[model samples]
Target: MDQGQLVRILLSLILVVGMILAAAWAARRGGLLRQSQTRRIRILDSQRLGARATLALVQVDDREILIGVTPQQISLLHAGAAPRDDDDFRSHLDQARSS
Candidate 1:
């Protein structure tokens, strides 16, 4: 192909790439691609057991779950009520001292 045809192709490719990047930027700015502010499930901690295995502590609402994860599947090791915040412990201590 001629120099003129090569330049046209390069410009078209650049324009298409720029349009895609701009669309992604616009979606992020408009919050269309953002995760929700209020998430019910959260990963509290995680530990790698081996090459393909992982132990994860997850909090879902008021429950704390211990899960074992591997390439094949995820299994629940244990599930219990979530621990109370440090503030709750402090408050209880203060009440006991006053009583």
Candidate 2:
């Protein structure tokens, strides 16, 4: 191959790699292109999620539940204790959900 062709190929590979790295960095920083993934909202939905966990909201269940988990702790929530009063994370979760 000609020297010019080799140079162009090398430049193209570098540009592609740089773009991929930039995209990954942006996603990690929660940029407009890519955003951080979280489990908060999925668990916040009442229909999809079970057992209310808020103060303004009433939770009737004996234990707070975490749904849509990896099956390891998904069912464990059924037996776990719910946070109550200021110590309750469910209430905090509600606030986070709003945000």
Candidate 3:
């Protein structure tokens, strides 16, 4: 095979791998969001769900939760969080940040 063809093949493989990884990551996040959303709805109900306009930072057991609510609805969602402990939290964060 020519050098150009070999390089093209390699680049194509890399691109494909990158795309696969991206899609997998996205799917993972979507799954997590659905699970959390489902849990909130089941446990808390729409009445407890907060509005997007009113949001407050609520921390619990190391994990930070963003509680947003309006007069009609309430929801407990994730915004951004820091590690709880140096060991367990770090490992969890590493896995999350990886895949």
On TM-score, the leading prediction is 1
lDDT of 2 by residue, 24-83 (tens): 888778766554464232233344233533222223443445434432343333434654
Residue-level lDDT of model 1, residues 1-99, one tens digit each, is 999999999999999999999999999999999999689999999999999999999999879999999999999999996778999989999999999
Give the poorly placed runs of model 3, Cα more than 4 Å off: 32-99
Please identify model 2 stretches exceeding 4 Å from their true place.
31-78, 85-99
- lDDT for predicted candidate 1 compared with the true structure: 0.96
Reference-based lDDT, each prediction:
0.96, 0.56, 0.67
**Best-to-worst TM-score order:** 1, 2, 3
What's the CA error at residue 47 for candidate 1, in Å? 0.7
Report RMSD (Å) for each prediction in the order shown: 3.8, 13.7, 17.7
Q: Candidate 1's error at 83, in angstroms?
A: 6.7
lDDT of 1 at 59: 90
lDDT tens digits, residue span 14-87, model 3: 99999999988998988843555323222222233233356666655445667767776767767456666679
